[model samples]
Target: MNWIYLIMILLATVAGGMIPMLVRNLRPNLPIYMLAFTGAFLFGVTILHLLPEVYHELGHEAGIYVVLGFFVQVALQGLSHGMEHGHTHLPAAEGHHHHVAVFPLLFGLSLHAFMEGIPLGFNYSDASALPSLMLGVMAHKVPEALTLITVMMHAHQPKAKLWRILIIFACVTPVSAILAAQLGQHFELVTKSLAYMVALVVGAFLHISTTIFYESGTKHHELSRKKVVAITFGLLLAFLTLIFE
Candidate 1:
């Protein structure tokens, strides 16, 4: 648990996140493609990395609450139902666009991101599990960061304001890592808490993956055989990654 490795992990997260922004200049279709790839990557991480780790740490009885993770996410989405759809008035503001109310969505994402740092903190090279957790967080952060960006942009917040929000979102991973590191002696409690957080993350990823695939403006009616193969291959790859990992 050398402190330097934690710094390295944090740096890697920053690098992983920035890759998308570098390709930010690409065509609209390219981002969509990247989004699809990122989605597949997240599905891989959630199913492969998070779920397995948690299941191993906490058996069936405690794990039943895992499905509660899905319900929790659905509840979040349901509460903010208007934002996902189209424009609707915020309850507090009464006439503003619904995205104004999207801070809760951002809050959920941030909380999840903060929870992710825990594993990265405790996960030293000695533990076989750390890498997958790190990779999943890294893979998922791209879209999460971009979503944070677009959500802020859609809200018409200033560039500075958006950056501030992104900065706060970015800091959570490292903060969680530090927190885990500080409490290293209490591994059991850490494992239990992380297990629940991972379950929550799996739910969040499941929702995002399905939403991106089905709800994207792309038309399935005209989806060609090749596209179908690509998406199927993409999903299959994700499942296999989970199984093997």
Candidate 2:
């Protein structure tokens, strides 16, 4: 079942990267809508599901780790140029160019994916929690992968190179999950450590989700009606998933 989940994740990642390449004239507003929906869903999952579980397992120390994770993501953005949060640093107009270093960008995105996988692979809380976590990760990954491919395309990376990077990026999380699961079986202290890691990820989620909200708006920080509707739908879906879970 875990293998199945991993394969699903990998396929979703690759498919996301393929989308922008397949469709030349993707609607300008599409990514913004995606960002709003996934942001709200991820935020809801972290607050309603992950935080309570981590705090229950690790107590106040978990809060400190959450803060650390938040800052860790802040630092990671320097390397990733905010790719994980749907940022494509494309130039504004025909005469301008923005240079992106591919290696650092891939490294940062891989690290973020790896961290997210740890709690899921280790079964941080229980079997039931996996569904919610998996759903959130999948929702987030599509826009993220789209951003990655878009950035690489703008940078004039070769098609083969782009595919290679996308494959590597897609594998990172599944590999991390498998590795974490193996480690948990061997180490007695894995449970507590897993709780702390989950706390860290919860913090990362909070940062990414809120950042989406912040960036999804106009100059006045007001959301457009369509985006607001998308966000509401996402929240409602999250709530329903929790109820059923």
TM for every model, in the order presented, reads 0.68, 0.93
**Looking at model 1, which ten-residue stretch has the lowest summed lDDT?**
81-90
Instruction: Look at candidate 2 and tell me the lDDT of residue 88.
Output: 41
Give the per-residue Cα lDDT of candidate 2 at 109: 86
Whole-model Cα lDDT of every candidate shown, in order: 0.55, 0.82
Q: Which regions of candidate 1 deviate over 4 angstroms? A: 1-26, 78-99, 118-128, 184-188, 216-245
What's the distance in Å from true for residue 165, model 2?
Answer: 0.7
Residue 161, candidate 2: how far off, in angstroms?
0.8
| Off by more than 4 A, model 2 | 88-97, 124-127, 217-221
